[model samples]
Target: MAETNATILIPDISGFTEFMTTTELSHSSRAIHMLIDAMLNAIGEEYEVSEIEGDAVLLIKKGPAPSKKEILGICLKIFNAFHSQRMWMQQYTICPCGACKAIINLTLKFIVHYGPLVELKVGRFVKQSGMEMIVAHRLLKNSIDSHEYLLMSEKLLKQVNDSTETADMVWGNAFEEYASIGKVGYHFALLNEARKNVPAPQAPQSYYRKDSTPYLQTTIAANFLDVYMVIMNIPGRAEWMPGLQKVEQDMPDICIGSLHHCLFENHQSTISPLLMISSDEEINYAESCRIEEMNISLVYEFVFKKVDEKSCHFSVRFMNAAELPIPEETRGILLENMQRMAEKLKLFCEK
Candidate 1:
């Protein structure tokens, strides 16, 4: 048996569960096999796929000094292949609802490292050992759990010079601890660009309605408010208000239990007032309170009048402390806080 050091590549599908749940068993099985075939074929062109570990495919290439550029290019090609298959599934497959969600809407994580390739004499078994493999496995695991689109180690990055395309594409430092791998740092890379030749999927225009009850809306809002209060330590009775107490017992129906649900669903829920308050800008006219201190409320509503057209409007209003019956001076403080919260919400929804 010949033992040598080489780069190991691992590529795993992202939305395996989504595909299995939505696709027919036979179709799902075929898709999985096809993906594996495509990956193995692409890797076979430049390296040997030593083993297929369930959903993940591992490849090894013995070197004549393979550059980081070469490794990145190979990884990109593998990603493109997966992307192509995903498009095919979306176009041809039918789901329970006559519409199929993409199974390959996943990204690949690559681990490129150099280590000793050991072969056991008792059997025809070959494996990699030492710090390189350990680092690679650790990095790969971390990347998967973090849902990173792509991840690479620092040692992997240094093999390529700054002038290289790989260096230019690296956006920013990834996980600090991973980036602090000193000679073996980790970074993320996106694969969508490499598949430019492939047609992109059309964005779905249809909207699905979840719940539209005021109680749900208020519940969602209270959840968000609690989080905000905890983070900022706002000095007020709002943290211990009876309305918030009621909402706490009943969790919000919104996704991730966020007040953003009210915005996403529009103000159709009845409990929305408990969650949010709407007032006219006229309240600010007579009040000397700063905008941040006033109790300003915002409502986000989305409506789709046509199949391809949708309108999203966010309405903001300020409530006078006189109307809420709170202290006059506290009005400006509450308004300012509400405005800040609105800004943060805008940033989150935009993304």
Candidate 2:
């Protein structure tokens, strides 16, 4: 056991419980994980992430506490990152499911505390345990009126001062009682004003021209969601699309800015999500790809129309390839390959 002083910062996703319970599990789970990743990225190398507990991420910095400005800067960075991620996902999302649509309701709050930490090593993992740690975790259940805010423990606030030079935050004081620790006082600042500074998501890339005609179209004997699952499943692409050896991405779930390096039997292509829009009646998706060997840019577009509760009409086209002046024989070969792939996709979705 190593006993030392440390600063504990927990970034908790608010409304996570209701969001997950009420929304579609498959999509909601992915959305939450992606938002958490955004916060982790913004935190960068400043703090050590101790553990992730469901909707909360526990981070610690051993020895010494950061100044008020430093902590506020970190919190603002995380807030911006979180909201920015949600904005982009909401803008380009193709899934009209409950989870994707309800993402806008999810928000964030942070708890900061400074105290003695007991570093206990169990197996390969080290756990931070102590009365202060308990106090920090307990503070999460406080009466903070708003979902988006920063709450600093009395001990920490004393060290860093309660008043901040950051003008946007609206500060206040509150206290929570626990059986073990009695009353713990804290100061909180609403982040609604800070969020106003978060930039809006950029427009989605337009890969396909409006006048492009479909090269092939088909109807899938499955619901819209089912067909979408099959299409967005990158690893499963090998099963339906021909010559696809493997697909790789840094993140597990697909989103607006996702980049996938697809390995084919004969060549490699870098592909990125271009456009995605969805509604009850119809859904649209597009991707832009650059073939390394051919040195040609191509856009793949898909439009899905709901035929009924159990079936959908799917149309696919290759756009912006006319500028490449692809030979007729090459275009024929490409069309044949896509036609076969579409048939296989339909079967895969139906199964």
Candidate 3:
């Protein structure tokens, strides 16, 4: 068995707990999965995904180790990507559940170690195992007071010290005790500077005008959050929405750029959510799509108001994005379909 040198990197999420009710638990799981995917997609081709271990993603690189500057650069990229996605989730969410609102509190940290490992092939899977692998995993449980930082093993630090790119870098020391390895020391750097460089996510574009009126309006006998959740349930739209045969979501979580194809009775349209705004008094969401058959672009706006604990007011408006005149017959057909769908939506939410 040949010993191969490898560098192990793990990006672990913090503030995730299993203490929640059914509703919170479900939303929390989806939110975490979305964040993890965001980090994975931001990684470069130099690293290979070894495994996804719950809240942490294990990545491995073969042969030569990455320099300290390169590792820090990658860490910064991961933090920026994670925070950008987190901001998007907080801003675009219409759900008021505890799990959805708590996404802002979630944090991410990294663990990096460079050492030798023996690869064991099981059927088709390649598993990297050795003492260095254990040390990398153990460093995840160090005495770092803050939740967000980068921890590098002392061996990796020594290898990095041989390079000349080390300047203006501040590091702290931390140690973790292992039953078999006695005590292992590592260097840590807080990610506050990296996080500060990430710009806030831009707000979604709005297509509403002051004179615009809702094409269809209805009041539902349910809470505002309940109505919002029911509408955001893209898969369940076929049940209450008229003429919608099915919905194919392009991504697991719905954000501003998410696209989903809707199969209707006669035609299909690609819908993308453009805006989602929620406040104490009301919640507003908007979706835009091009009606190729009519050669017109349309924006669908949903406004929900909390009238009381048991009931709320919901209205749907259609905006012409192209600012072109719409035929009376075409407008009439749209209103008729919306009216029927509104009735079914109320029934579904209230029941």
Candidate 4:
């Protein structure tokens, strides 16, 4: 209703244009989508995503200004999530595709500005715009001289007091000019160095069946039992699952207590074993444990609902998704793989 204080943040993917042109179209889309999804997950539910403009996401947080520790904490979460996701991507999904392989070259940076802002609901869409928002967006195209950085407006720095400053909090001031706004001063915080020892996110929460929680659900056009059977056959999943080079069942019969080992993408690395917990005609449960960068324990749940004789609703969810950093992409990659598996299964079952 009235102008209120807000923080506008833009996390942009650097060198995306080149990534798109050089990598395979599908792979480029998947890789970029994964990275962006990871960033969005890192940002969490704290801020509102006003819009996604190309390779950048515009985030706006409106309310009383958060304290220096709070704002810095939020920034560190985003930075750690970004870094963890990137490194995890390289370690897992060891594919040779240009897009999959190109993550090593990708980098992320954020431009944040805090000031007053007003919002208007334009028809079905909520439009957020203000002088401060423009400043945040314009700051993205700056000569910061660094790719992995967090640029904060001087207005924000004023709120960060001396006690809150840590040894790694090295910031340098700069200025820029724009029409209407004139010259605006800002500071650059080296995101990587600033987040030297932030605690990584671990310990996945209990499987949230709520609408707000992160999950993937879809219906597949295939026989219900047939779909169930396909997923139940864990070893055969490598054919449809992405980055899966091999799946060997350590315990035969595929029942409760069955252990399935995995070799990812190539023979270079191995994933945690899949311990079957529940197995039924229309439902299945399993757990995957591994220590890559950090300990990872992912609980897998699958449900098959019959739509009719020829088609059915097949949904899979990954919960207890923790023990490592940035569980966002773990869920993301699993969801993506599930979608593809459903498609391939539909194609196969219909035949």
lDDT (tens digit, per residue) of candidate 2 on 178-208: 9968999988889887778899989776545
- Please give the TM-score that candidate 1 achieves against the real structure: 0.47
Best by lDDT: 2
lDDT of 4 at 232: 64
Models 1 onward score TM values of 0.47, 0.83, 0.83, 0.55
What lDDT does the true structure give each of the candidates? 0.46, 0.84, 0.82, 0.66
Model 3 residue runs over 4 Å out of place are: 18-27, 91-99, 162-164, 199-203, 212-217, 248-253, 260-263, 266-270, 289-297, 307-309
**Which has the higher TM-score value, candidate number 1 or candidate number 2?**
2
Number of colliding residue pairs in each model: 21, 0, 0, 2
Give the clash total for candidate 3: 0
- Which 10-residue window of candidate 1 scores lowest in summed lDDT? 280-289
Against the hidden true structure, what lDDT does model 4 obtain? 0.66
CA lDDT of 207 in candidate 4?
40
lDDT of 3: 0.82
The Cα error of candidate 1 at residue 206, in Å, is 23
lDDT of 3 by residue, 1-351 (tens): 568888899999887654134337778888888888889988967689988988888999887888898888787788888999999888777566778888877888999999999888889988888999999988888889889998988888777643454355568887888989888889888877767778789876544453455457788999987898888777789988888999898777666767888888977777887777788778888888766776767778888899999899999877777777778898787778778878999999999
Q: What RMSD does each model have against the real structure?
A: 19.2, 3.3, 3.3, 16.2
Candidate 4 vs. true structure, TM-score: 0.55
lDDT of 4 at 11: 82
